[model samples]
Target: MTVTDFDFICQILRQRSGLVLGNDKAYLLESRLLPVARKYKLASFEDLVRLIRVKSDEAVIKDVVEAMTTNESFFFRDTKPFDQFKQIVLPTLMAARPNKQIRIWSAAASSGQECYSLAMILSEMAAQLSGWKIEILGTDLSTEILDRAREGIYSQFEAQRGLPINLLVKYFTQVGDRWQINQKIRSMVQYKEFNLLNDPRSLGKFDVVFCRNVLIYFDQPTKAKILNNIAGLMPNDGYLFLGGAETVLGITDKFQLLAGQRGVYGLTTGQAAPATKPAAPGALRA
Candidate 1:
């Protein structure tokens, strides 16, 4: 990757996916995207970068972006959070919205792990949820990842990460070397391409939004913008979950911190109702 082309690609990625890449990350890019290069039959990273810039090839760009997006997740990744969701969040939502209809958005649903995991959770409680309208929409910025997500297949190694043995046996079948998620579980969620930096109006509202492990890539301004944009798409009393390390305070004042949790935040009682903020700031400035 030449310095000029690298900078150009980095700028475009930063704009499109909020990925902050610097010159020093050239090696990281090579290490992470070389598989992409191999899969696409490009001879080298230089060849991949050349095709990306000169041709402005959308497929190649999608491959590069998909290669860079973080997909670190597992079934029931964090134990306590799921416990909180089942014990507290679901009950609150059921009471708050008597219709039993709930919409969940996994903002950076890389390869669909998080969304599928949540689907499994909901399915286990399906008996009590028979009357509800449940919709799970998972969105990522990468076309390549979304394709894999739609397939709902995982290798033994991939399935081993955070998946429990019992659930694995029940929800998957061994095909060749990889473990495939069952069709019933796979069909529970809808995957789509969504750039958080872009307008989110048409994506609709959600009762709970899972946007974990992706915010650190954004600069503070971009982080605030993404946060505020997500808050806007959430119901007033809706719940928002960030990565355990992420926070809404000091970044954006749109969400009030939950009583006893660090990463969990929610809108004020009447804030999400025909809401108006301090004239919502710019993405970077928000």
Candidate 2:
């Protein structure tokens, strides 16, 4: 693609998805979008760019954006965030929520592993949460991935990634070579198509949010804007879990790190910290 075409594609991604692509990733345009071009029967990448520029087909634009957005996810990815949820967040919320209801959001929840991981945890504690109402909403920019997430099926390789052997055996049934999460676990979560660039107030309030491994893709100002928007969707005392490499420090003050917690943060103007202690560090891979 030409320089002008490259810049135009960058603008479309930033405006639609808040993703900021630099010149260093210029090579990705062809590697990723070429298949999209061929899928639409375009002659070449140049022709695809011209179609987007001249005719501006919304379908093509949507596919282009979805194609570029990274959807890398795995069961209980990175371990610590799920540990925090099970050990600290859930117990605290159980005590504080008078109505016995908890709502959670997994933003950019690629293929639903993260939210489902939380569901599995909740299922393990079913006796304690017998009378509670729990809602887990997993939203992503890609409709295609959200469909996969809703199906709750995974290949053997995906099933094994960071998922414990006992939980896998208990919660999943082998469908041919792929494993499908049980109906009870799948029904505990919902999926939606959402863009982080847009407001989240319509999704309603959440007690806990897992917007992990997503902010690192945007620029500084976009990062701050998205963080502030997320803060609005959460209560003063709600918890936010980011990727191990991401932080609210220097980016936004709406949240502050929990003392001794690695990837967990609570609202700055919220209530006191939870009484639970930090979990011991260990690898949780299967």
TM-score of each: 0.87, 0.96
Task: Please provide, for model 2 over 69-163, each residue's C-alpha lDDT reduced to its tens digit, 9 standing for 90 to 100.
Answer: 99999998878788788888888888889999999999999998998899998888889999999999999989999999999999999999988
lDDT of each: 0.79, 0.89
lDDT of 1 by residue, 105-191 (tens): 999898888888888888888898889888999998877788989988887888877777777888889989998899999999999
Flag regions of model 1 displaced more than 4 Å. Answer: 35-42, 269-286
Lowest lDDT block of 10, candidate 2: 277-286
lDDT of 2: 0.89
108: Cα error in model 1, Å = 1.1
- Steric clash pairs (candidate 2): none
Clashing pairs in 1: 221-284
